[model samples]
Target: MVRCSHVHLYKNGKCNSWQIGKEDKKRMASNQGSSHLNGHSDIFLATSRDDQILFNGILFYLGQKYIEGAQHLPWWRTDGVILTVLLHAGPVEFLYYWLHRALHHHFLYTRYHSHHHSSIVTEPITSVIHPFGEHIAYFTLFAIPLLSTVLTRTASIVSFAGYITYIDFMNNMGHCNFEHIPKWIFSAFPPLKYIIYTPSYHSLHHTQFRTNYSLFMPFYDYVYGTMDKSSDSLYESSLVRKEESPDVVHLTHLTTPESIYHLRLGFAYLASEPHKSKWYLWLMWPVTLWSTMVTRIYGRTFTIERNIFKNLKLQTWAIPKYSIQYYMQWQRESINSVIEDAILDAEEKGVKEEGLNRNGEFFVRKHPQLKVKLVDGSSLAVAVVLNSIPKGTTQVVLRGNLSKVAYSLALALCKGGIQVFTMREDEYKKLKEKLSDEAGNNLILSKHNVPKTWLVGDGLSEDDQQKASKGTIFVPFSQFPPKKTRKDCLYNNTPAMLAPKHLENVDSCENWLPRRVMSAWRIAGVLHAMEGWNVHEVGNMMFDIEKIWKASLDHGFRPVTSFAESKAN
Candidate 1:
């Protein structure tokens, strides 16, 4: 009996992640052209891809169950394989070529084929989006090879499996919208072009809608005069295309060892949702250990995400070191080396702006001669925190490790006639020295008083959270979010905003931020490029808070309100 191994398919086969070609590279540089469908679509549109896979599975199951002499077929037979190939390259190819052309005819085109052609820019999944009736017709056409082998009692399980796998691979490759098939293959064997089709070949079929109608082979198209004239030129150009530099690059680091899987290159579903550690991941502890060891040994910067806004290309790169490494004194130099290399690389790429989180500030400060505008996004983050504060509040307790954002927020609050209280004498004196006489008067030292509003940052202690009254709001100005200790108290998300409607491919949430939301620090870099600000907003330097706030709104990044604050209001 033929033994079939249960196979679980990854997205577009195993090579999808590694085979990003020129066009695929371009698509990878932006989130706009991903294969994931939005949930807002109708039920049919949403589930159509899954349904197509199911349909194929049903066809295979029925063929095995009902066909005579199919169940106990041998695993391999040379004659069966040769016959299958000849039958497919002749009968199946010929039939499919004409059938595809007929689908484009006016009557069939509008009724069924148009659904498949709806996407001009195709992804791998786009190959399977035909209507149910079209699927039945196409499957029947493909069944020619399988049925012939079965009826003749010459069928082998390997022959059937190989044919189906070939079909699936070819279908996906043709619609991938990227040129991955190496030109060398065709050059070595000129006859292969007639037998094997490329992505550019099928792309012409979609764009022109009248030519290149051969299925997997161009022999019939050449004979019947339906071949596209520009096919070879397009393929050659796509092969020689060079990589383009992005306008902006945001540098970040892996938060946890498991956080590696949360990157877009890792798992699509996990990357899209808010990041959280799964309990089952421990089962792969050996793999995780190897990854962590490899990353530590070969620490280099790598691309994490790619995005586009307006006409500008933006990319997010992560330092190989995990978050814990950043805190180790021994790891500081290694971390600095990775960050400096990234900054220098960005500068070389003609990137106008590079954003670094708080961890990267040391490098920017140490290297004053850098030409690229390095921004920490402190101005916009401060703006987000200021706007999150509830109105009609006179006093706010400032607690946590004082970072640049926290310092700026305290000054802004004090200047706006709101009293700022600090529990630590050293923090109060440090803040007092920087504040103007008018703002300084508003800064107070107190320990026992409780205010409903608190502007918190990193290093916030559990004791501090425990002291807060019920319904107290904790608004963070730090790059990292503080741990939640009080359920009754409302803890706002780290400063972030809803992304503009035009932001495409926002299928994944940013860390803990909801879908279509971006952190203020990240957005600040985009704003700098959009406004063409020449000055670097690094170290203690900050832009006008009001200006930044207005610009964020003008660019369509809406302020995110905490649920607790919203409920209280």
Candidate 2:
């Protein structure tokens, strides 16, 4: 039979492959061309793996019985044994090359070899795994070596057993995924390097799939011109790696900001509602959260004044008559369109991009270099994240005519002693009309047109210097910085566009801040979720206001409403 060693064939219950849960296994299979098929479905009708293995085993035993009873030859006559052994190797290798190549034919690849390629890394026991039809083809081809000796009546069972054992030994070694050939051996006999294959040599075939298709030796690959360019270098590297621990990556859903928040909420809800009291019934808060998330389909729409309803038009007065879900969906679509337009506009204006993919799409490599934890979180989630910045950070910078919601957010940062830097006096005055009198005065805006001085500290390194960096926080509604400028002393929360991707979960509770100051809290939550800070730190800011600001950005969680006897600490 053709010696196929690179990829493993099957993995069911004790599978070390990526699949863990039943649902996930089925989902994984969906990507591999069988989206509609069930995970455990047999390859063909009446072709269960158990039945195939049993049938193949019966054939092997019968072959052995026939050889013993019918060969009628000495177990080991030196001349006959030698002749049969020499006769077996030549034709077996020749036929195997063609048969193996045929297996890669489009129809055969999908039906037969695709099952083998499922495992990118092979284990030794995975050697015999194959489709029943594939095994049948193998059995027919493997009989050539035995049939040649028998037809000439030159067969000795002893010689046949020795040849078969050699093939199995070499095949298992190829699949072991460990380099057993020492580097000194290759250096000692350079000619033997042409004949022997390493685990790394076969592994390239599994991962890259275009070259290195040989069973016993790479001689055919050399003659047919199918060798991979990196095979020899890879083989050398695998030998060096033999003494080191192998790298392994486990496949599973990683923790996210959403899952973290959900777990925390669920944990506290259960603690407060321990089984001793009715509060214990609040253990269902996660289910409630999930349900609200499932049902939350809403958005905040802007108007000439203020509109609480889900308004479609930008400047129209809106009444509280539409579903929140409809509003949120509208905002999602509007955001995507605006972002697309902005990107195109930037490109037209000759704005340079940092990173480009194969498809020629430009990526913002330096948009923000957040801590790894906030890599995939929403921009808005940062509004609620907290840092250890002193409660005395009181500077403001306004860049342009920003939304009223944004001004209110700047006001909150000012309350926490933050310094914000923004636009010139004319721009600040225009923005002042959008905010209420109390918020407008508290903004603490800084005029950026005037130049400021700073110590150079040119001779001193960062550690040697006595001073540290500080400046205004930037959370503009929209911004486009000049080419190649790295704005470090700012937290530019202005999104590229208001796309669905820009939002957190597309649910109602996603932005369920109280109606009176919804914009401020939402912006705060987004700010809070970024940097190395998170929602828990934001919670610390409201330790005294137990009833109002207990949980997360929305402050949605509360103890039993009637449990007024004692407030939770």
Candidate 3:
């Protein structure tokens, strides 16, 4: 007769070498694997083929008893009863062993299995405390088996309810971290030694993985030849190495940018809905504000500072210490240099002819000829306007920072098609002095004049600055600097220009403008939805609007009707 902790073989005498250590027992309890050692309950060993037969026998008997109790029910009802019970009970046991093995076999152990092993030794509660997904899988296994066999719905329900209670109690007992069962029970039942599933057994299952696959019954494991009869030393060796820790796996990669964008859009839609009423909006408003504030503060204080430190650290520790002052100075100088280069480059690079129009609106030519008359009275020619030139073309305007590369990009754009307007002579000269001759030539200079609406600094009025930044009209060809005046500009007749709508007020630009714009857009979208429009309808409308907008660019006409037609089509 084999004992619970010791295997007594008739030929080899008593094999007492398997006595579990006190530390191991304690470890098992702490880990929640010690719940299987109750004397009042029957323990099933799944290590050997004989154990598997015994477990099956128990399952069959349980099924038969359930069927016998429901014999008075109709045949169809009885079938339903048996199916439901088997479905409810069988899967839980099967998956406990199966998923445990699967987690070990698959790479999911790093994330899924490590939680189970948090206990070096097992305790009773540890049996079922797992990731939600793992728990669901375990539940599904039992659910499917019981549902399939039980014919009567009520019997199935009763069996499931009982099975759940039993499983819960047993699993809890296994991880209780204490051994309260009597030793006499084990002494009387010699084969019970191999049968009783102990915390030591289950702890070894987690600690080693190669052995102890059984849950309530060890018979399944024994028949399947998965039972590891080896000593506890083997279990200790299989534990995850500290250096090869599973924490290295990152789960963030599962999320994608598109998903994040859509989620944000959904939030925006929800927050903006009018019918959602004021209370919900009020609840969410703080979250939005806090997120924005935190992001900005983090960027300014941490991200920017970290960048400064990284750049300066290679040179000296003094850099990070003086980063603030250094960064300020650097930014000022760079801005000044960029402005100068932009002016100079624009002057040198002749704006190229962008395109010609048969309508004869300023010949529709590119502006490539760029000339900068320095404040010092020296002038520089950057590049020739290769495209056709129109008569009476004077002054060029440029966009972007006054850096050589920016100037060069502008020049490239001019060569592609855009016209040059005017170059600020004094600013141009200062820029040339800072750059090498070769790089100076590459600087981009635009032929388009800075719209009066855009010139807000110093000499300009607040109203003028606001108009320049927010004006929808493009500056006319005749408004090129060095010749045009405020009086010469027409208010409403100019072509629509693209300006940063959020920068209308200088004081408020840093704070209120972005929030206001975002809020407005969200509100608009929500209001649109509240009008009983579906998401698909909204998406289609947006798509149509975009199509028309693009078509207008190519056809030289704002095709509103065409947009409607496209949406309909």
Candidate 4:
């Protein structure tokens, strides 16, 4: 009688037979006993169930899509395999390469691809445990080859189903915590050996993503020069030292503030602090205000032009000379073209400027509306808002000069019924005083008490400061007195008091805030600003008013207006 480790009794009072080798049976009994002893059977079952559910869901969705596509191409067509391979292979290879590169792109890698890399030491389950977007992207990309094929409908469907099953098994086995499958099995069918991917092969692929991209066959990877043989050597070497402990790998250190900012931004959407009561919703108002102030103060100064050439050079790790020359040439052409157009417009408008300098710097000596114009005729706008001027307290200083062009913009936002908050009584008084004169008595100023927290301004009792610092935005302004100069505000005493080390390297005011903060700020601010205004009017007004403008030629539109003088009668 053949004994099986797993036994099931039939309703007919008979037992189904399965082969259980003597050694295998003993090992199985030992593992079961150990699991029972440690009370780990439930944990194992739960893990297994989770894995099964996830795998089944992914597989079912992918399979359904494949089947739908396959229905159009039946299996009766002769030479279908040849046609399918020919048509599908090239496009699949291209898309695979493109997506593979895109996965490594700075933004995508940080958010989506990084999740996959979390499992430094991968198992088959790890392959499927990725961001849903990434998983979908990979699945879709893989299916493209089948979709592009000219195989008969039935053949295509059958082949795709078989392929998925094969892939699933291979992926699982690759991460299988076992070694040494029968070598004779692979040797029996030499071609099928390459056709069917193995755990060993797929394991190497995960270990080093640059190679082993081929799902079933190595032919495409070889042709594309992406098939790395070095991973094979690494795998073989690992196997040779089977007795050695599994090598531990740690995640790469996120050493910069920018990295941390990105991480926080990605997580912020999903994270929520527990709250109760309608009034707690108002707490988010202050958070929104703080986010807006920090984002605006930081995002502008750090705007770098997106140069494809520079990016390519960085990717290749090229020398500075070539990169700089490439950048300069591109910059020169771009500037010159803008200047030519600007010069023509100025000449037509009867405006004069100083002769273009060697560096093409031009200056207008006098212009009523134009504060300062570049040789390229670009203008600068500055806004200065000084608030909270009181004795013994640091002045709430906002110093940036707004150009005549931006006056209308500022007015529109203020006029759109935004409740501007000021800490200083005098500052609020000044604004209120001007409102009737400038805004036709539409703007009203009420004495709403400013948050005491805002007045604290880096000055509070140690415990209070610590509490304020816990979740508050810390903007390190050069103009603000340093820790040594500030008598009241504690600084550099502990990690909480000090500016994050990453912020030290970030010199530009514009680049200080992360992108997500900027996005949230704009969204929150616009909503708040449009509170009393007609939604339609506010929406129309906001049509072209960009909240965040990158430093580029296209930064803000030049509004055209026709100025006419009344005829002398």
Weakest lDDT window of 10 consecutive positions for candidate 1:
1-10
Among these predictions, the greatest lDDT belongs to 1
lDDT of 4 at 2: 6
Model 3, 93-120: lDDT tens digits are 5667777777765357655655556544
TM-score per candidate? 0.78, 0.35, 0.26, 0.28
Tens digits of per-residue lDDT, candidate 2, 1-569, equal: 00000000001111122113565445345433322234653443235345546875787677667754344655765665676545444565556667777776666766776566555566664455567777777667666766666666666768667766766687778777767688898798887755767777877766656577776677677778878888888777655531111011000110121321222123344222211224443666676556345423322211112111111101111111122322365544543333233333323333221110111111122223211111111222223222112234444333333433244445555445444443345545654565466655654345333212111101223331112234523333321121212244443322221222223222221111111222222222222322213222211122122211222324232211112225343
Off by over 4 Å in 2: 1-38, 41-53, 64-73, 79-88, 242-569
Superposed on all Cα atoms, model 2 deviates from the true structure by an RMSD in Å of 24.1
- Backbone clash numbers for all candidates listed: 0, 42, 107, 15
Question: Lowest-lDDT window of 10 residues in candidate 4?
Answer: 1-10
| Candidate lDDT values, in order | 0.77, 0.39, 0.34, 0.34
lDDT of 2 at 310: 16
User: Candidate 4 lDDT, tens digit per residue, 52-167?
Assistant: 56855777566556755544545444354555555444565457656765665556766566555444345556656555565556666656545545233434555555455755
lDDT of model 2 at residue 349?
30
User: Per-prediction RMSD in angstroms?
Assistant: 9.2, 24.1, 26.0, 27.4
> Considering TM-score, which of the candidate structures 1 and 3 is the better prediction for this target?
1
Task: Give the local distance difference test score of model 4.
Answer: 0.34
- Quote model 2's TM-score: 0.35
Which numbered prediction scores highest in TM-score against the true structure?
Answer: 1
Candidate 4 Cα misplacement greater than 4 A, ranges: 1-90, 145-157, 177-198, 201-229, 238-569
lDDT of 1: 0.77
